[model samples]
Target: MKTRLSLFALLAAATLAGMTSPSALAWNTLNGQKPIVIAHRGASGYLPEHTLAAYTLAIQQGANFIEPDLVLTKDGQFIARHEPMLGGTTDVASRPEFAGYKTTKVVDGVATTDWFASDFTLAEIKQLRAIQPRANRDQSHNGLYEIPTLDEVITLAKTHGVGIYPETKHPTFHQGLGLAMEDALVARLHAAYGNDRDAPVFIQSFESANLRYLNTITNLKLVQLIDADDVNPDGSMSLVDPYRQPYDFIVAGDPRTFADLLTADGLAFIAGYADGVGPWKPYLVKTVADGVDRTGDGHLTINDRRVDGSTGVIEAAHAAGLEIHTWTFRNDASGYGFADPQAEMEYYFNLGVDGVFTDFPDTGVAALAAVPEPGTYALMLAGLGLVGAMARRRKA
Candidate 1:
């Protein structure tokens, strides 16, 4: 309900704020202008996530960056996947060749019985096709696309002039399996870009140890990914909570949670090793409980789910000279914990966020276009006039 303003009105407001001028904006670590829209797993809302098709679609939709969650194969080949578990996102279960790989393994202290990526070679992984992981999303595209390697993803990004946001998924777990991710990642990146700080890439990780290691090796920017469940309401590490406590912390016997990393001192420390923080959106703005709905029907609904904007994380990160790039923006009505995706994005834009990770890159692009910088409105008007002239000429 908050995003009631027309697109033209938003553009006008942005123009008034001098956002149309390149000089008015400070460059982020990516060397790009602010309010960047990163395609989360490559237009994932429309296609099977982490596939070449998805990444290409995101580039076509004008996303500045495409995200790839990196997991390694048994041969130490880096691949794009949401997790090491292949059951949910890939058609591995149906592949009889990989049926033996379907066994229980403790990933980050949780027992998961699926075809793990580490158990299969890259050739074996190529036999499987990516599928839509979410039941609510379109499943028709399942089996149409193969899972892509990190090298393949990087190639696509370079070819299209788009950026790459690669997250080292479960680094500590991968290291335990005798496959350290950071060195491989660094080698690939160095071979391609050669220590270029502004090479349109951001290496991210949930655990600090790997990111810190990467910091020592690569000049490329690093992002620290924070999880919501990692901390309690009282800001203590909630190890009992399933996604709490980074595995590196657990391994090192450190009791700190993701919340500890967001403190002023924490951010200052991160600035020494990392360039930005990619936090879950709630860390920036939180949805408050207003009431509960008891309808005549058996179905129940949340009466109020409006976001209380600007939680100071953005300001704090900026104060520490660390960019704030929040994650998991979906255009769906329910998932984002806000009224609508546009409202949610607008809230962050208002908070001066450096960038966003969105499953719907088109929506993100359109949302940013709505609040166009100073010269954008003039271009839009010129394009409209040209269209009108063409229409009149055609009639003649």
Candidate 2:
């Protein structure tokens, strides 16, 4: 079976072939003139996520930055994992030696019984091989790669001249385990790259307080990640749910939802402490339908969901002088109510998103290349006319 090129892929090829104006380059960001393509969990779609191999693959795919979601180990070492849970993304369950560590623990308020990363020392973690987190993805690479430490990920990025975008996954939860990710992250960054604002790094988190704390400690850029659960079904923001509010907000008894953080006042508050915001893609372009259970059975059914572009969140962020980088762009048609990854990316790009976190970096790169500048369509039309004339002459 032949593969069909995505719309963005065709656009990229045309742009490269001089069919579009030269100004139709990649999208611009606060980091640089070109839109940044962040490899979500390090080319996670190809290899085992958070592995050095995956990071290397993302770099090869032309990702401007590679993301590694950070979690703490038992011995207080910083390691890369989507979450502290080891069973889902590693072969820990198959090992008999670490079977004793299997127990239930509340992770970020949810009760998960697995071989938690916090329960294993850094040495113990090295013994286990990283596996594909999703069952649908290729499992051949599983057991072939090992979980990488933050230092290893940084070293890989440095060696390849790619930027590192590391997120402090479950910062409050890690702090409860006596392993404050902020301190470790700051110390590691300081030792390696110093307190340079322009350094090729961006530390991100879903929670707000830790980012505010890091603002006092380092000059490195910080991004605030927003989750889907932060928004209520009625289009209002919810603060009562733990997932909807920052853990610190809940701890301090503050009644504010993630939606509050996106307002002009809220963005001003974030601007006081952080460089940018990383919202879920839906926050920018939500699928709207009347009387339809978009969340039926707790999963978004693709039937009636239509991409009603721009929720004004991007404009609000840009107005606050804060860059916006949205998350988790995949080539598959599973969750994002759209068939074309290019269209989804282009929608965000047109909305002036500074960057995007995609599991497939190549797709993001292509989509960014497809975004045209002013007068690109005019040039495309002229090119098409010229091509038609040349074809007619050849036929005659």
Q: Say which candidate scores most in lDDT.
A: 2
TM-score of 1: 0.83
lDDT of prediction 1: 0.80
Candidate 1 local lDDT, 1-396, one digit each (tens): 223223444555565566676433443223345578999999999999999999999999999999999999999999999898899999887888767778988888888888899999999899889999889899999999998998999899999999999999999889889988998899998887789888889999889999999999999999998886632333233445445656898889988777778889888978999999988776777545444332234433432444566677888898898888988788764232455677667667766788989999998888776664634455564455555555556766
Estimate candidate 2's alpha-carbon lDDT, on a 0 to 1 scale.
0.81
Clashing pairs in 2: 27-35
- Kindly report which residue stretches of model 1 are placed more than 4 angstroms away from their true locations once superposed: 1-32, 230-240, 286-303, 333-337, 372-396
Error of 1 at 301 (Å): 6.9
Q: List the residue pairs that clash in candidate 1.
A: 20-373, 20-374
lDDT of 2 by residue, 1-396 (tens): 011223434554566576764444433444336578999999898889999999999999999999989999999988999888899999998999999999998876778898899989999999999989887788999899888998999889999999999999888888887888898899999888889999999999989999999999999999988775644554444455656777777777887778788878889989999999988776787666554554455555543466677788887887887889998788864334466787778778776789999989989888887877645564565566556555556766
